[model samples]
Target chain A: MSEKFSLSIEDLHVSYQLSGSAGKNKIARAVDGVSLQLHPGETLALVGESGSGKTSIANAVMRLLEPTSGKILLDGVDLVPLQGSELRAMRRNFQMIFQDPFESLDPRQRVIETVMEPLEIHGIGENQEQRRDLALAALAQAGLRPAADIGDRFTHQLSGGQRQRVAIASAIILKPSLIIADEPVSMLDVSLRAGILRVMADLRDQLGVSYLFITHDLSLAWMFADRIAVIYLGRIVEEASAVDLIENPMHPYTKALVSVIPVPEAIEGASRTILSGEIPSPSSIPSGCRFHPRCPLFRELGEPEKCLNEDPLLQISAKSESHLVACFFSDPSKGDTQ
Target chain B: MSLLEIRDLHVSYPNRKGEFFAVDGVDLTIEQGEFVGLAGESGCGKTTLALSIPQLLPEHSRIAAGSISFNGVDTTALNEEGLRAIRWKEISVIFQGALNALNPVQTIGSQIQEPIRIHDESVSKKEAQDRTLELLEAVGIPSHRASDFPHQFSGGMRQRVMIAMALSCMPKLVIADEPITALDVMTQAQILDLLRSLCDKYKLSMLLISHDLSVLAQTCDRVAVMYAGKVAEQGPTSRVFGSVGAQHPYTQRLLRAYPNIRHERKFIDGIPGYPPDLSTLQVGCRFADRCDVALSRCATEVPDLIDIGGNQSVACHLVSENQVGVQ
Candidate 1:
């Protein structure tokens, strides 16, 4: 696997048809001109608030939603161009782990039966017992208990953490190369979130799994992800290595986000850069830079003219090769900001 | 006197197989002008304790033991009318999920006025309207939006309305039971900041209950970690967060779950087992089955809440008896 990138999203654009008053036709661009690449065995966390187009990007990549425009290249092959049975077959290379584990798994089906469905659909495994054994193996890899205990249990019988492990078992049973986790641990308690992350990390190491981790938690993204991509309204504001982004974020939106995260040490009445505005509706995004409405620079400098007139593209500076940001007044390494 | 005190509180529900105790023997106290957070996983009797405070327990359930005192008065002994007198006027509650808690048919203004109307019928409609406007402004919501229904408001704004309703009667203590659970992280911060400022402005005591420790650590003065309907540990937020001698592995595992932004590329270490079922009677420590350092005595004898220095307390065997001597 000497590939340059495991999953490449190139100029991806996703739109939804909106109905106006009196049934008028309108189009809403949910994800616009977003491009990024995830390395093999590395995690690229797509972070944003609700309606920030993070989930839309995830859906577009998983082919759960049709991409109106743009290309999704997997292992040098374009997934967008493929259609019908060919696209369905191509989907086998990527698997999705949903946010709600209890809702994702079938309620009536037993654990073995649920995990076996994927194997059976993929037309792998020889017999029932073999599928059972494979399910047990996947469960064990996810740090589940003995094969006998989990085989006959229903989804409701298990706790949130255990059900998530079961979901992980189901996703990895097919042994896909890419895993799309959309807020996988958001519903669970804090004590169980780390355990799930560890399981995902172990799977990535052992089986070489690339991930598109979507979440609203910046702290988790800073810690777990190899690279962090900040999405706002429908565009990528910034993309950089996790450490670079956390320690020295260039984009104003990213900086505001990082500052608001309440860490234990940072709780001593630290004067944080608090952005004072609400998340705008996706249908009616602000002109120019999507974040211009809430950007402190727009307010403090009283120079909303340029920020409200020109759209910014993610551009690289003289810092790191991988680090990129989309802002009018950003300097990558130094605070020699424009 | 403490604004609120709970001594040996126990809540149980009747089932086909006798009775099931959701909240076992537990004790807690909230001082005046202090913000105490009650944190635990789901089914940890956090909500049960909250419901028990207002004498709002379900018909099938009752306070099997203990007493709840508010403003030096025994709340458990209060009758329906007696509880009503103190409900919003003395101690108010803000339930989780603003959409469900708010009446969709009523305007936000009327919803807020309901508390005032029920508490003091002598106040005229004009006074109620004036009070509603003031409450809305205090919560950062515009007075004009009071005419809007619950559905018209955003999740965060609706939560503000809920807070406005909770503060309508000028209660000394406000019990927010997972008020921001359904909101986004940014909205969550905004609401928390509002609550912090309001608590300061009014000098109001609060009982903030949630399952997320990180969420509570931001605004809480003190925190009590609950497990199996019992307080596993309680102390100042900083000391409890930074380092505490907790003998229970459950508490230790919870501290490890927070993601450290400074330490990138490191994986989180989550706890292994699930919480125990509340219905089952345990002879020893309730967390004994899942505890990593469980001793033989853990299976047969329950650990009492013992002091562990610096105003902290833990109910575990790992901390030396000298360090966590029984109170």
Candidate 2:
């Protein structure tokens, strides 16, 4: 166990049996043997397309959903083995801020009430007034100006950005060790997105809270996260520092994903590797490389026998020491596929 | 001749209080085979401008002043019948959300067929079906999936289906309003690539409206930067975004704020204040209140869009004078 590591998922495997009569008692693996570590006071972004099980992994970390197998270690304790009331106590250490702020907050509750809910639930505060004071302090920290005036207002009265602030304030009111933000700014307007990201960044510095930021936007991931893990078909295909991942992506899946991002000012249109087909369903994932069906490099390499049949384990690529990718090519710059 | 031309267009809406000009004194030209991007934050009247082009505004809204010409015909003067005749045949639209735009009850294939049937009454149902599937294939959707309902597809697939439906009648000009805003980064890239290829394949002129500067940068040939319903800057996409000369306060903040992988050590302070209440009529510049280094003159008089050598137009008092450069 690393003391500096705030969160760690070791060989996590989450599965659910097929629902209703259609289920022949077969398992649908949503997250299959995925693992990553988030250091204290750092942001680790999980970037992937929708239905890539990014949110599933987040839920497992927050203990909202129990992982079917493997260990979830938080602060040197294996959360997987904990059960009943003990697990509930451990759950308080990590909080989750959802994507839709409008739906997440209780409609009838005031801002102050919403923020103080966590404190009341934990029975940590001395009294109602003490909880109210703590809630107001959290509100002020999240940059809700004139905090006293806004605390009594309903969620509807506040703008999208303000609602998000309230949500953040509530998540941090308990002063949790790790915050799992699942696409927090996806619903916000373009300009407001930056503000929300900045608030999260500031909170990380102030409270020393680690973040597991899940989003589909790589550009944002590049900006906010110290390290990034690229998930494809419920598996982390590549994981590296933000700089290494962006500058020299090794995996064919990662390279394809990175090339699609539209650079704001670049005049020359960089050619993208157009994946030939749609992402395969989770039930029928490709055997060797989950991305091989849509991977242009794999097709060009013309080794379907091994490339599509033998599963490749996560290994160090030739790009950088910290960078790791799940690809047989080893060196992408050498044109192994070509 | 330009495919679409607007001269001094003014669109206004009346509420319980008073009349507010959402699109005021705006002029633009979309030449044949040109892809022009309309960029602005929410409530900046970018959508209002797009709607006004097709006379698709709500009952409260009216074309208070100006002329909109499409293919040498005045669109503002067209009656309901005349507008209906030209709506899909000349200029089509792909709206923000495809799921909302699509008919839930009807099969996507039939919905597409309905448009082509309406456009050419003499066409047989079999012909329409064949054409619909062909259009679907063109937009990169599986032709067989056209038989499926809108609810069956994902967000990205529905958008592609929307593109197919928009181009079914083969309109010369397409107005896509925030087409990819609802999609993920990868899907957004795929949709943009599809649009780019479709536009090139058919030589279609497009009016792309979006707040995402990066998407606009990739898909559009020319970009129009709008603030409060007026185009603050319009020019070649590369010049407007790449160079410091085309920097407006809003544009500069936009470039800096969005998290791009390429840039480093950049700290963007959020635009301090909110957008002005359009209902409260403004005599001076609408952005003057929020502009960081606003001069006294900015509060007194509105600055016109000054041409900066090239075709770029910027409506900032400070940037027009080259006072601040992009750091």
Best by TM-score: 2
lDDT digits (tens) for residues B1-327 of candidate 2:
888999889999997796898998898999888889998889999999999988888888999999999999999989999999888878888877655778898888998888899988989989999999899899888899877998888888888888988898899999999998877667777888888888889999999998877778878888888888787778888787666435677777777667766667354456767878888878777888877778888898888877775777788788766634532
For candidate 1, give the lDDT of residue A216: 95
Runs of candidate 1 exceeding 4 Å displacement: A1-3, A20-26, A126-133, A332-338, B242-249, B262-265, B320-327
What is the Cα-based TM-score of model 1?
A: 0.93
lDDT of 1 by residue, A158-235 (tens): 888889999999889988889999999998877788888889988999999999999999998888888999998889
What is the fnat score of candidate 1? 0.54
Against the native complex, each candidate's DockQ, computed on alpha carbons, is 0.54, 0.57
Local error of candidate 2 at residue B106 (angstroms): 3.2
Kept native contacts, fraction for each prediction: 0.54, 0.62
Per-residue lDDT of candidate 1, residues B99-176 (tens digit): 577888989999999889888989898999999999999999889988998987788888899899999999999999
Candidate 2 has a DockQ of 0.57
Chain B vs. true chain B: TM-score per candidate = 0.94, 0.94
Worst 10 residues of 1 chain B by lDDT: B318-327
Residue pairs whose backbone atoms clash in candidate 1:
A194-B270, A195-B270
For candidate 2, give the lDDT of residue B114.
Answer: 88
